[model samples]
Target: MLHLRAVCPAERTEAALDVLRRHAGATHLVLLRGAAVEPPGDLVEADVAREATDEILAALCELGIDRDGGVTLEVIDTSLSDHADRAEEAAPGDGSDAIVWEELISRTGEESKPSWTFQAFLTIACLLAAVGIATDSPVTIVGAMVVGPEFGPLAAIAVGLVARRWDLVKRAAVALGIGFPVAMAVTAVFALAGAFTGLFDRAAVFGDQHQVDFIYDLSAYSLIVAMLAGAAGVLSLTSAKSAALVGVFISVTTVPAAGYAALASVLGEWDRAGKSLLQLLINLIGIVAAAALVLLIRRRGATDGVTTRPLSSG
Candidate 1:
């Protein structure tokens, strides 16, 4: 899954090889005794490995090669292998030492790279929600939830915090903050137009409503739902075995809440509209806070020192 080639001192070759064999997830091991030579990538390719990079890197730190000594660690993605005879070694302690903060940050960056398609998806979700609100159709409201793409940035923000990438955090925050308001504004315009046309004021709409039909109900369940969604979102980003993020995205009601709020505001139900807006705000704050907290915990395990690359002026 990962290809690693390292050049180290003749004396430390065995030790480095031991670490590689023990924690690098190398099916086959190779070590060349020479001066510092860069790996295939000019920079250290730490994230290429499918497994155990974090553990191997920690072993390197423990072996004194990371700090005092001069050994270059290079990793890449390839199926190639070079076998080297080595003495038997013990396995790392359940491979807990690897943190790979750089790799995590890089992944977050990759995830945060936005596309026009996502914007289109958000627009569609908002419009679908407006239609649902206008027609009093809960099924269409759920459709809107399924269509929204807010989870990408939500998960991206969580990963950024775990990786200590403030730039990513800022970008994700901006995307969410701006996007939600934009969606609400667009839906609000539609709601106002629909209200003037008597679409929302149709007979027998509010007369037959049940107690549970309050779209603006900002009860404990509202906060609980947001909390659960936030937790699942972060977990989906971190774990390799799970790809349940899309489901989480569909289950979250943020866009629906906003659309409903806009519709209610247009219908002169300011009380319900304000409650729905508060619910939306609560969801956003809860998700962001939870994501940041999770990331902070993950960052504690990171061995890579903080990188201070200059921001691009363009």
Candidate 2:
């Protein structure tokens, strides 16, 4: 369930309220007229079943209430009321299967932005993977996987492409575009330092690599696993099953590939470096393509089920 609040101008309050009132999935409606301060409007709040969120939000967006004022939504973590159950039952489809597009847009939009935190996490993850590569440790490689932050921008690109939100698309693209190379460069410096200090084995990279050669050795599994992980990642985000994301993170080889590639470059293993980069590209492409396709399918299915045009940009 979601608690949705819409601030509507006085002139548009009735229309907004009427939309909410007519929806069977929207209950606990409350309206405070002239309650908005900055934009000066009426405050209307409702408990919306997750299954009905896309429909309700699309209707509100059509009214330009989002443009004139705004819409805010938060998950109802504990709705103990019977009315909530009835609301969910009254809505089409199950909440778990429903797509709350606005929330997704908001989430991806924010996460897609490049930040110092994003850089630090990516750099650290790459560095960690480099260390794991240096020592031939699968456990450390897995740890690096869990620490990677590349998925945010990857999912952001999917949502941005699906929504045709160029601002979001560009932002996510820039994040990924700049993020990987910078991370690899940093990992290379770390590898160089390790070499100088006799802490890293430049030739261990050519050894067995603890059977982790899959990070650079491309095959069908590389694309297949990446695609599966990508789909799962997007589903985790859209359905609010975020706990599943860690598994998705561990399934892809992106960060490890970057780390290995960086180390390979420092050791002058041009062939290995190139192959690692190709592996990384495969993962990125597989993820973005699968993620975008899933979003497109779900969003389209929602629109068709409602017999409505695409949700408005507002």
Candidate 3:
């Protein structure tokens, strides 16, 4: 469900159009031939195309049309014929007006950065968990789970693995790595400050906190959950359906473990802190490893028609 438009020279228009038309998924294609004033040599008319499925889009990208003239490609989501008509009517008349994948991923990249907003969200989420534990409030604990910002790094790691961009991988790793310690330190300072101020009790913070301690006990289920969530995260990134990703974010314990570690430090429960830290590490490692594995397998499958390759980077 994507709408694509391209503006290329008249000479290459036929080949491009043929490429688009031969694909069965491309249903509506309108080719207008002309030249733009700024680029005098090239054709100015718009060639509009729409894909009903993502597979078709991938196929077209794999074709990789290399042309000298200016070309703009766009993808639009259409659920019905009426929507397609509306997309056609709304097509851009000029070179500036076009749909492109790079643009879509760029906007996504901007919103998904590890910025102060994410820091604030994680801080608040941890605070909520601390308060929830103190007040014995299950609702607040779940709210904390929902508010945590654990998905950003997970996603960055996944994207880096898929695109084979180590710089992105390192940035995401650094951001996530630093973010956890910062959050833990801040939580400790605040929790100790609260304890001294008689706002909360050390015992209340660390006493009999098994629910939060659940993070430390790693099992097969842990690996399974990480793999499932990581795969879903990548799928969410590539596909149009994004709502399910939020639930996946909340289900993972990366942020909560960091919060608990900080809270444990404030309470002087070093054992709890150590356990939580271990859990956090296990989950983070599990997620990164599983995500990398999944992407590798998927890429190999796409290229070789084999989905499960050996789990070695080499």
Best by TM-score: 2
Off by over 4 Å in 1: 1-24, 27-51, 54-100, 110-115, 202-214, 297-314
Residues 123-215 of candidate 2 have per-residue lDDT tens digits of 999999988877778899999999999999899888878877767778888888888889999998888898898887666666655666777
Following a full C-alpha superposition, what root-mean-square deviation does model 3 have from the true structure?
A: 7.9
- Compute the lDDT of residue 244 as modeled in candidate 2: 94
Better of 2 and 3 by TM-score: 2
Instruction: Output the better candidate (1/3) by lDDT.
Output: 1
Clashing pairs in 3: 2-76, 3-74, 3-75, 3-76, 4-74, 5-74, 34-43, 34-44, 35-44, 74-99
Model 1 pairs in collision: 54-98, 55-98, 162-295
* TM-score of model 3 (CA atoms): 0.70
Clashes of each: 3, 0, 10
lDDT (C-alpha, whole model) for all candidates: 0.60, 0.87, 0.58
Lowest lDDT sum, 10 consecutive residues, model 3, at 305-314
lDDT of 3 by residue, 1-314 (tens): 45555554555566666665655445456765564444433342223432222233344344332233444444444345753455445432221222223333343344445678877787788777777666666677778878876666776676566665555566667667666667667777878888889887877655665554555555677767876777676555555447877867766667666777777677777887787777777777776676667656644433222111111221
Error of 1 at 59 (Å): 11
